[model samples]
Target: MLKPWFALCALFLTLGAIAEPSPRQMALFNNNCVQCHLRPGVGAPLVGKAQDWQTRKAQGEDALLRHVVEGLKGMPPLGYCSACSEADFRALIRFMAGMPAGTGQ
Candidate 1:
């Protein structure tokens, strides 16, 4: 009874995870960026909306990474992902900006 329900819930969670980031990246975003990113009018870019990221994207990955590392406007230093590596930030930025892979420029 309860075992079957738990199993079904686990299956859905696994599927959801599979459709997106690796578990580590997902965990980082969940704990850090999700606080402002998924919300409206928080002054941080909204995930999955390209327009929210276009101007920033045009600045190139290096600039964006610097902003994340150094803090800019509404973003705090390290964008609050203190545990995130440069590689993690890169991938997550592209994902939020909707840029095609390797096209962060």
Candidate 2:
């Protein structure tokens, strides 16, 4: 009785914990990436533009992630998303590169 209810609650809690980033995280990504990327001559590659991303993507995902974390020629450290975790950086790279999430190098 109580055990079944507890199990169900645990399952739901686990699922919630593994769910995607909250709206706040999405907003952070948008605020940080969109501002620079969308503008021409910003040096930051525009999101969803394969041509803009090709050369960067050729550098490999690990390199790309390193650039985001450490900052490249024109990109700032943490890609300006100070609150972002490594996973968040990976997602952002994939999103910007126009690659599907979970697609590894």
lDDT of each: 0.72, 0.69
Residue runs of model 2 more than 4 Å from their true location after superposition: 1-24
TM-score of model 2 vs. true structure? 0.72
Clash count, predicted structure 1: 0
TM-score of each: 0.75, 0.72
* Residue-by-residue lDDT tens digits, candidate 1, 1-105: 254335435533643432244578866976788778866898998776668888988998789889989999899999788899988888777666665555532
Please list the residue runs of candidate 1 whose C-alpha ends up more than 4 Å from where it truly belongs after superposition.
Answer: 1-20, 102-105
Colliding pairs, model 2? none
How many pairs collide in each candidate, listed in order?
A: 0, 0
Indicate the worst ten consecutive residues by lDDT in candidate 2: 11-20
Q: Give the Å error, residue 51, model 1.
A: 1.2
Q: For candidate 2, lDDT tens digit of each residue in 2-29?
A: 5433543543354343334446655676
